[model samples]
Target: MKHITFYLDFISPYAYLAFEKLPAALEGVSHSVTYQPILFAGLLKHHGQLGPAEIPGKREWTYRQVLWQAHEHGIPMQMPSAHPFNPLALLRLAIACGPNRFVCETIFRHAWRGGADAADAARVQALQQQLAPGRDPASDDVKNALKQATNDAIARGLFGVPTFAVDDKLFWGFDALSMLRAYLLGDAWFATTWDAATRPTSALVRPARG
Candidate 1:
């Protein structure tokens, strides 16, 4: 069986989208998925990039597009009371709660299913009661796990959430889910075009801003 490591942060709506659709995308395929809750902010800092919601027009577009995708794919989604709020607590909570499919799903739904503040005190308490129970999300072990997971992801060259890592290949974005499934199905192109596309060298580099 193929092993796939799914890297995610609950702040990403696309990650929630990918999570909902992954099982169907892998229909008739034999594979095991491991969910790793990493800090999205850590990735952004490591990669020297801004999160989607931090960009200009892209912020609004990202929301609009994901909602459109949800409608098209029949996935239930609603805008949270906020976007790009701190996801550290949620990430640590996911780890503290065991980081399994059920844990991750419950957390994602809490953030994505209702049009309310995912980080609101009441909402977070509800999640803790239901999913984590008596587990301490702020405990040292859970906190370290999240940090280590994010470091490992950065080392793997992952710059974003909703990433699927199959062996050495990294597929980023919910839009790339189809590509990931194609790889899982043993598509010949992955052995051909996929390698060829990355085999070229850049003729020129853009000058760095002074």
Candidate 2:
């Protein structure tokens, strides 16, 4: 059976949005999804990249864009009280649940839709117990598993959450879902290269400051 690897982090609203829509988007397509929880903060640090929320203008635009995308997708979304909240416990819990999709979705909703503080260890443990009774989020195995997953993601050239990998091709961002779907459907355009000479220049290039 064919499968796609979904690398995600609960701290990302975009990841939550992607989790909500991907199943339906791929309906009727014969492919399975493997959810891999990773430390998004680790990825950012490894790549020396600033998240959208770290930038002034981009932060505001990202919040607006996320809400717009959620509305368009008819999904409920509420920003958590904190941005870049610690997701160590959450990631460990997800791994404890054996990387289950339902568990992942529940946690994603708790943070993004329910506006819950996923950084709280106690709260995260409670949620994990609810989904996987008797599972220990603090277990060494679970902790190591999450770390390994993050390392594996970094090794695969993933610097963002909600990244979908089908075979060797990797698609990042929730907005890339359409392209992924088209590729899954065997679209030939994806394999064709565009002629740079025929490309038109942008009409809105900003002038350099004096």
Candidate 3:
């Protein structure tokens, strides 16, 4: 069985998109998925993504084009206005939910599919109310939990969400997940004959001394 750790943020449209279809993609495969919530914008900055506005016009246009692709997958998404940079609160709530599958799945679906402004105080609280009865997403306990999760995330060298880790390999981006599934299945034949345990033949060959 392969273990997959899914690190993601609610603010990421691609991450939201991945959540909908990734489970089905892994169906019948021996796998387990764990949620690890991290700060998306901070990670992007570290990866040299100078925010959306700084993107080259051509690249930005191409990105906007991908939004249309969301519809093909039956995902509801758009560049929400006033998207907040702070995902720490949401991350905290996910972490608090821990291995509670129902809780995590519910929040993810609502935030992504329902267009919930997760960072908004009232909206986030309302979501909590719906999901957990008396549990408040805006409560002091939730706030403290989020703070602790953010601290932990930073200490772990995490930079982004929807970051999937299979074994020792870390795959970022929704597009890269295809490669991740291939790895999990021990099937490199589709793209190449290389085995995960063995490096490509070229990389393994030693140079003759001149």
Which predicted model would earn the best TM-score? Answer: 1
What C-alpha RMSD separates each model from the true structure?
A: 1.4, 4.5, 7.2
Query: How does each model score on lDDT?
Result: 0.90, 0.84, 0.64
Ranking by lDDT: 1, 2, 3
| The best candidate in terms of lDDT | 1
lDDT of 2 at 193: 36
Candidate 3: lDDT over CA atoms?
Answer: 0.64
User: 149, model 1: CA deviation in Å?
Assistant: 0.4
Clashing pairs in 1: none
Prediction-by-prediction clash tally: 0, 0, 3
| Local error of candidate 1 at residue 123 (angstroms) | 1.2
Tell me the TM-score of model 2. 0.87
Q: If ranked by TM-score, best first, what sequence of candidates would result?
A: 1, 2, 3
lDDT of 3 by residue, 19-59 (tens): 77687767778898877666676666555555443457844
The clash tally of candidate 1 reads 0
Error (Å) of candidate 2 at residue 128 is 2.2
Pick by lDDT: 2 or 3, better one:
2
